[model samples]
Target: MAVALSTVAEAMLMDPALTAQIKPYEPWLLISGVFVLFILRRLTCRALRHRVDRIGYRLFGERGLLIWFWMNAPGVILHELCHACVVLLFRPFGFRITKITLFRIKPLVQERPYGMLQRGMPQALQLGEVQYVRPPGRLVSHIGDGLSAVAPLIGGIGAIIFLYWVATGYNIWEVRLQLIRPGWPWWTLLFAPYLILTITAELWPSSQDWRGARWLLTGLLLLAGIALATLWYTHVLVFNEALLQGVASVALHIDFALLALLILDLAIFIVADLLNRLL
Candidate 1:
């Protein structure tokens, strides 16, 4: 399988035409796709929320705010759980769930917030936090921090893969093989659009998340640089081939998932607008 994937990667690298054809879609697997997903999810949340609030206010008056919070609680809980799980996995020492708050009003009262800031009056929002004992080393600490910050992304990727398997009754490797042979099941498409949107919406890392993960990124760059230098010096074709093949295979799978997410976001926007008009 590795050799076959390496051969495919090598063939694509050798063919300028193939590279050119695929180049335009590369952005969908990186930062651009993430940015678009965040924006779309935000917009969709706002739209659906408006509808929820409008109906709730009419029925429940001031309690509508609480209703809104609980309605969205499941996703928020899952997001926090992902972070906590990653921290526990890496730290191993111990961890604590610090807070799960529907409203953080202390900062509003103080006219200052420790983390994020908003200009308007106080509003209730769901947030979760976890605290864990850091490992006692520089390199290990950075890796742990990075993993904790990126747990949601890892969870999102797993969710997409799981959804694919559930839909097609085949694991990721089998699906990839089927895709290679142009024999992927059409039934998988039915569930994929929904799962892709769900995963992409939760995959984005916050500004705070990146701040905690800076050392991890630095460590990764250093390791990558070392690896490249070693490969260049040794001229190890096997290692290079294996690495390229692995990357290409993973990239192909993620690219498909992200493209589906993009399409789903568009559909959601259109549907949200239509629903708003009807409301």
Candidate 2:
């Protein structure tokens, strides 16, 4: 009965037009987001100092920093990207991979039927696979997460450099225009804070200092919700129809995707916590 309900719910959530609205520029946003994430990490380590060390130790033991860089960071990026890429590759018909934000405010992949109950069942079932990748074997399974996280960092830098090279050949005005042109949308700048907060929140070790980190994560989540609401109310209401239209178009699926990713992230954190306890 549960399986049947889950399958039926999944079928209802599939929408090709909605999916198409979500794709197109995800890779670029992902790459940019990664670069921003690495920068924030460096800043956080330098500024937070002892607090970070404590969090790291709590999450990953003696080699906390190494574990964070190699394990958690990568794991998160991959986890998010897996949703985006998988939808792109497999459910191309019903899925749209529209926009990928450097900020992890929302799910990497937004689908149709964004309602909680409507979205939750399908995601819970799909993410069941991640559970199997556990323990000793998990170290390897964790690799996907790590690589996914790191890929954007590497790709983003490469892209910026490539853009710089191309810009060099043009006139000064042209170069200026190019830098602030068709490629880099003005909206990206506006979204920077959310991206920074999201990445930092995600990659920061959340186990040993579970209480503190969890509190922080909870706060960030609240802030994200507020920001999304504000954006929807102001921009969608006053200035442009595009903002509301874009959001409305993807609203249903986004809810489902966010719920799924949150569950997966929680699972990873739980697994890491349990492993730490066992060891």
Candidate 3:
């Protein structure tokens, strides 16, 4: 199985290689990284979020959700803005984003299962949402909708990278080389982690974003496969490594930034879980 499109879209862009040494394992390595990301997002991220929310709820009830939503304001705005921005770019192609909501004040009421019985829960609130209108069943709409659905992912990752640069003097290679910059200000790094938390938590596309995206993406994958096969057969296909490797490098960096967030989230989760149990 492939990585979820929204999570690691660039992994799918791996170009076919001509070299026996790097070609075979490059895609596999990228795929594995994506698989790990999916696992982390599904299990680790989910657990961390839920654990914190549990603590908040235990303390403040539904009001806790409101507070949590407000705390994640940066990410919420970025997420919705990503959708609206990308969708608006498709305006030339006949798509119009009808609404751009940064955040909402109301709680999301839904049913939950408890002992084979369902009960309504009002502990969840929507932080932000973007709504677009497009002609149904058109190829253009499908492509537009699919791209827009995953825009938050690209935006979130970009935000993380930017925050890291702002805090670390953008010394990416220094970090890689295990060299610490002397006399770095401690306060410069203060808000990056919290901002990253907000971004990652809100990055995943909501189920509503996938309403018209799955079919479009499936079709795209099929088309890409056919294109690769056809071009490979012609013997004139250019085996590009530089571009592919560059993209992979950037993606790896993005993943590492996210890994840092996961680490911090784990620490927070431990504290939240412990506090919840005691209180």
Candidate 4:
């Protein structure tokens, strides 16, 4: 039980994006989730947690396992759907929807004159060829790929903004931050990278050519580099002087960097994959 809790805590800490997201309200959520898990673990004879952990590992892979670092397509699709719905609500006629289909094709051949046949014969009929493609859409067509990337960032940023609004309204910034400080476990910071990655995905340009994909990848890398550099500089010049008051300061900076890189890498990979498939 101790080992399990430690492992879970470590995993959460390592994922800076997740950490950042939960950091603001860590004590309340973490304590509540843990207490709930504890009770449920007892009720189920610890079977449910084991089963979930096993399944999650199978789906998400063990930590630091590159092969397991696959994106959840359903999550991505829903994110895109949310964007589509929003667009339709505001500008219904501006967008069109299309469904993608996959099919198989066979080649056909025709007889030709001897001279023509000698050069090249007409294709003969065949039946086993297959092709997979996305269906056409106007609104989704233009933004499906892009929207998936953007939704998470919007969600994360929006959460932060909402928090700020609430804090200001109730004069809770100091109180809330203080309450959250102790339980701001490392894992919650992962949300930062998650947001960055999603936004980056939204910003990546789409193209059906290898060259274009290369350009997009290059641009993303450059942007990531710039963002990282800016963050580092700010940490040194501003955060160090203004905010780093305790031992947690170094950890905080490191957490921010990790989240940023994670986001950048995810964006680059998704855009590159899409470009490759199209090409």
lDDT of 1 at 55: 59
- The C-alpha TM-scores of every prediction are 0.58, 0.23, 0.70, 0.25
Q: Report the C-alpha lDDT of model 3 over 1-279, residue by residue, as the tens digit.
A: 355764555643453433455665774576467558757766876776676667777779866646556667888888778877877788888787665657555444343211011111235555555667777767787788778877787898788777766666554323353322456566766787788788877777666555445776788899999998898789656567765676666666655655666677778778877887898
Clashes of each: 0, 20, 0, 31
Q: How accurate locally is residue 278 in candidate 3, as Cα lDDT from 0 to 100?
A: 93
What is candidate 2's lDDT per residue for 253-278, written digit by digit as tens? 33332332344345445555555555
Question: C-alpha displacement of 53 in model 3, angstroms?
Answer: 1.8
The local distance difference test score of model 2 is 0.39
User: Model 3: how large is the Cα RMSD against the reference?
Assistant: 10.5
Q: lDDT of all predictions, in order shown?
A: 0.57, 0.39, 0.65, 0.37
Better model by lDDT, 2 or 3?
3
- Order of all candidates by lDDT, from best down to worst? 3, 1, 2, 4
lDDT of 3 at 234: 93
- Stretches of model 2 off by over 4 angstroms after superposition: 1-61, 72-246
The residue-by-residue lDDT of candidate 1 on 163-245, one tens digit each, is: 76666556654424343224556777776656555545545565566666778888789999999888778876355545655
The weakest ten consecutive residues by lDDT in model 1 span: 113-122
Error of 1 at 145 (Å): 2.1
Model 3: worst 10 consecutive residues (lDDT sum): 112-121
- Model 1 CA RMSD to the hidden true structure, in angstroms: 9.7
